[model samples]
Target: MNEEINKIRELLDKIEKKNDVSEDSLHGTFDYFELPQIIASVIDFLQPLLSPYESVIYWFLFRHSIIETADRYIRVSNSQIAQGIGSKFKSGDKVKVASDKAISDNLRCLMEKKVIVIVGDTNRDGTLYKINLPEEIELCIERMKKSRVENTCHVEQKKDLDYYNIAENRLLIFERDGYVCYKCRKQLTRFSATLDHIQPVSQGGDNSYSNLITCCLHCNSSRGAKPIMEQFTSDSKVF
Candidate 1:
């Protein structure tokens, strides 16, 4: 453990000394893209929104630097991760070994949040499971790359802006709008309904309560990028 800590410290020193890296390089199994700080920032900002298993799974992918590829096509048996977590605790007397059931529950939580896609059963050949990061994660990855290039912490500020689109906020908006299309007054059973920014995101509108309105898929498509006021005044108004 001491040796591993020393190695990590050495790597941090190297990263602090050098600032050259690329997005592709960051995806490797052990490549340090000299943006550990930015990555850490993103994780810290997002950790509150993730479960313990979700956090572990994310770091596992990060260590391997396979977010994009994993999202495209990935697979891992439930038992594998469970065993991995168990092994991690075996060396520590104080840490409790995670049960298979606990690992399974976290996996389900991750799936429900769209953080990972289950490609197949763990009993299959490879126990395939694809990791699908949310748009916010992808944006964070991009911002990390940009920060490495620009040598700025602007990406940190953008984190809050991205938070507005998280599932919790979306759900709140859906509930506030009564899960019904504001224009057509059509009822929506659940998340199937679209969330239209009353002020339009393109026009600097936010995802706050005052700016959100629920709409059915058909109505949402018709509205497109047009501003709400414009839609109302134009013939495209669905109401």
Candidate 2:
């Protein structure tokens, strides 16, 4: 009886894939000439609204489906997202894949936010998804309008616009962390505060804002490549 159910499920998935192949092809002729503009919008607008996990999963799907192929539809699984996306936990010495349940929940959250749509049924291969671009998403559209982004097919990349390496993005992190050492609780200025990775980069941690913490130079250097320091009690502790 189990075997019969499995066969039926497989057959249905195959049929769904066959039907969606045309849907994918409809986008095959799409001119991706304006991709850079869309990329800028995703970075500047859409990304800020998504949770860290959702951002990682969204990028993974975007890279695999839209960037790798012209197809916006990609088939993926919760395990695939958990493994493919970069995340590290301090559970053990070795880097570990994020919990599958976290990925699944974030995927649902993304759908609820209308960032991605489930286009087809699931199978052994995985479920099919259609990634919605920033321009299509309501939140991004509002941001785009408020930013007064002119109607142009071309967009120039801004200086210091990316992660902590960039001046603008670094300032964002400092502001978010309140310019205080997350580990030692020491207050710091932008010039003295350095960003520390929650999960060390050596351990597969990413530069997402969620993974970054502000710390004084002493704490940043002292905690280098080590597990997070114990929460220090002295907010006014010097050095």
Quick one: best lDDT, which candidate? 2
Whole-model lDDT, candidate 2? Answer: 0.71
Best by TM-score: 2
Candidate 1 lDDT by residue in tens digits, 5-122? 9999789657633432322122333323323433555464445568766788656654433533422344565556655553455455675556778777887787676566554444
Off by over 4 Å in 2: 1-14, 22-26, 88-95, 149-239
Q: How accurate locally is residue 158 in candidate 2, as Cα lDDT from 0 to 100?
A: 34
The regions of model 1 sitting more than 4 angstroms off are 1-45, 65-72, 90-97, 136-239
Q: Which ten residues in a row have the lowest lDDT in candidate 1?
A: 19-28
Q: Total clashes, candidate 1?
A: 3
Question: Which lDDT values do the candidates have, in the order given?
Answer: 0.54, 0.71
lDDT of 2 by residue, 20-80 (tens): 7753352645447646655676899799999887898999998998788877788898888
What TM-score would every model get versus the actual structure? 0.37, 0.54
Task: List clashing residue pairs in candidate 2.
Answer: none
